[model samples]
Target: MPQPESQNQPIAGRYELLEEIDHGGMGSVWRGYDAVLDRPVAVKLIRQQSVTSPELAEEFVKRFKREARITARIQHPGVPQVYDAVLDESYEQLFLVMELVDGISLRSYVQPTQLLPVSWAAAVTAQVATVLSHAHAVPVIHRDLKPGNILISHDGTVKVLDFGIAAILRSDVTKLTATGTPLGTHQYMAPEQVRGGRTSPQTDLYALGCILHELLSGRLLFTADSEYMVMYQHVNAAPTPLRQLRPDVPTALEDLVLHLLRKAPEARPADVQEVYERLEPFLPSPGAQVSAPGQAGPAGVPDPTSIFRKPYAPRARAGQQSAAGQAAESATAQPAPPVPDAVRAAIKVAYSRSDALLEDDRFAQAAEVIGEVIEPAALALGSESRQVLELRMNRAAIWLLGGDYRAALPELDALSDAYARTSGPSSERARACRAQAARCRAELGQVTDALAALRDVLDVVRSVDGDVSEEAVELRRDIGMLFLAQGRTTEAHNILEPLHADLCLVLGPDDEMTSEIAEVLAVIRLDLDGPPS
Candidate 1:
């Protein structure tokens, strides 16, 4: 451990030391003030050792310089900006100056009793993916990515810390760490990494997997009485699936986690881009409500998902009085021109085009076409008219299909309300709309509310249609998935086991739905049995 420097002393005659922010085996980090630049900075001072020989000191200097160079090469917002690396005349002390990040380390957020929301965990992982993507492009492997090295900023931006052990994948530089010893946190090391084998971008993915699993389950991926045991588990033991511990975790997400934890580096997702794509469905869309709205953990604690939930959404430009006046003027001015017959026909053509585009997987173009008709259709026909409502509903469905849940969720809620009024609350369309909204909620990590809404819908469907009806059966399956997500495996098994039997009788075992239910049953059984030895 390095002793703290005198508070009044300034390193390199520029960075004025203030107070210690953190200390680890490597060095001490201080909250510093740049006297010349008149700005705050984080100063990391490498611990000085009384080496008996010059060779050890020279080796330390090379490692220190390598860390600074590798970290600087990673040009990303998720990484703290490296300002300077200072070596004194006698080489007794080393210092690294960097941007002062006002945030808490992710280690503080890990709790045994309280797990983070699924979206929050996914969002953090996604940001880390973005960071890793940038770092890997520079051919730098983090080698160590534990919770302690991840910081959630005050604005909810995730900043990956500590590239002190990062390895620059260049043909020229020799291997840094000793050949026999692995370099990473025991709980998060990939099998290849634990075996002291070559590491690549996939090693970082493996570490991220452990972090995400911990975030969702509120516990480490593998915990043991000794570090050696934990390392052994990383190499030889299979991870307990997140869904087994926290049922509210989506099956898709659990599968992603498992893929990331694959023992072989090649078995993981091909790149960070693939990991980010996998995480997209679980990330909250712009303006989407978070699972725990308004309550972002303890006061002053940042919500990691805020970036995804409200990414640069501009506030209303008009002032309060100007907005009110504009609204009143619009209410009186909107009935001026009538939509022509040609325009109505064009709108119909647009809807047809959108449907075709949707089939081609051109979601953005499909959405654009549907959006183009919405205003014209609403203006010609009343906003509440069947044609306009149908157009809006179709647009919402497109948004949902595109995975733009922020836009889809509000539209679904409004459509549900509109259908309840126009077509009676008991109407199949209204029930279907509400059920779709519940699914959106579930995807957004509002599991409890989604489960409740699903139950209510299921009750209504069962009351009107029979238990064996297709709609009721589908609802039961959705409910079972929610139960599985919430970690209620017994309940999920109980519900899905019977539902699978019914599907076989009604839809036959060959049906897609039956096959899907069968897969879920297999997963549940595996969870019950524990991982294969």
Candidate 2:
């Protein structure tokens, strides 16, 4: 979340960066101080070269506001407080003002500390889970939940920072003509995330499991030399067992972590609370004797410093040279065996025209393009290829529009199950598929199921690096209507009111979502036969 380079410039005429603290593919963070608040702070300054589109710039503003509002809603002591969001100078760069934390990231703490004592790891995990439960309750997903994002303060307090904003800076720019969505830090990413599927509380659970695995084994859950390979691992790799590295690691903690590492989101714990409950009874309470609670050492005693690297190196090697050589090899061997030219051409023809068809209201034709045309073309390439599943997603969207929700079922359901094996339960793509499956269930009149689908959307959007996009607004609108249809007046009003306000802000009063939600409210009022409820 800290974007370096904030040190040189005065942000919004208030905070001035002192120096670059860290840098990454997304942006850089800086150490700084708030001139107004009169305290030390961190500021993230997005790179100028990275800003590629006007729409993306606008999205940055919206997401920045979303972070400001959403994160501020959580007063968790284990979570950093958002000081301010400053966007100025043509909106090209944003400086996010946040509480300054002087501590090593959990990733770093675990490297030299390798295989933290189970009790210490569990206590830390519990603290993280506690914060996660609240964040999920608010329905915020921290798309990137690797060790670097977890901070162990000087006082031994554990704070979860850098929520889900990273993806806004690094989406799939190369995949413009591609059917598949981009992904997050691949190693820690859950299986669902790799397939451009949906996420929920379970996605975070998967990440926690990865953290647990690493903490106990001093090893990454997956090993790939490059980002693509890491992502492939998420899409199609089995996790190594915790006990494989350290046989003495407690059976239940190992079970709990593996449970989170399930191949399917459905098989995982429902929320962070479940993760906490699974590990807490054995954990010593905060400030308790480190040995008793199962803490590694007194919070700062052994020190979590040097444990792992930030955003984490996907694979470990005996030396830096070997690691780089492996990375180069992995980069050169992507999508394995290379997508064929003919298959590539066919995929381009079948999948590249989504928005145009949606605008034309040729929903069924679009479905045909994806299912009959693109899907077959992809299958002609290889039915089991990543491109095949990618195109299937396009077809599923069409299925939603044509109101043939059941027809969408085979793709959605199979994809959901497939992603569990591919990405692990926690990946954003896996979560996305789960959310899409939920939508299909709702459309099919499985009220109990639809509620789950909409509920899952609420949780999925909270994930880090997710593409909730317009789907979020659409889900709110759909849920409002569904509740009204079910004669659940109170629920309808609750969903519709915020949906109306959000639509008004983004789409303006003249847009369809705003207009549609307005009409729904009117119907809701009439149904109440009195007040608007």
Q: Specify the highest-lDDT model's number.
A: 1
TM-score of model number 2? 0.52
TM-score winner? 1
User: Candidate 1: worst 10 consecutive residues by lDDT?
Assistant: 316-325
lDDT of 1 by residue, 1-533 (tens): 43455447778887877678887656789887665665678988877753335776776678778889889999999999999998765667788999989777888778878767777788889999999999999888898899888998766889998886787886644455552467787878888877777788999999999999998889999889998899899988899988889887899999999999998889999998999999999887787765456334433356777787778644322122223234434665454435568557977798888878677666655776788777767777777888878888888888788787766777888888999999988789889889998998998888998899988988998889988897899899999999998889999999999999999998899999999999999999888646576
Q: Against the correct fold, how does model 1 do in TM-score?
A: 0.57
> Model 2 clash tally?
52
lDDT of 1: 0.81
C-alpha lDDT score of every prediction, in listed order: 0.81, 0.68
Name model 2 segments beyond 4 Å from true: 1-9, 112-114, 164-183, 285-533
How much lDDT does candidate 2 score? 0.68
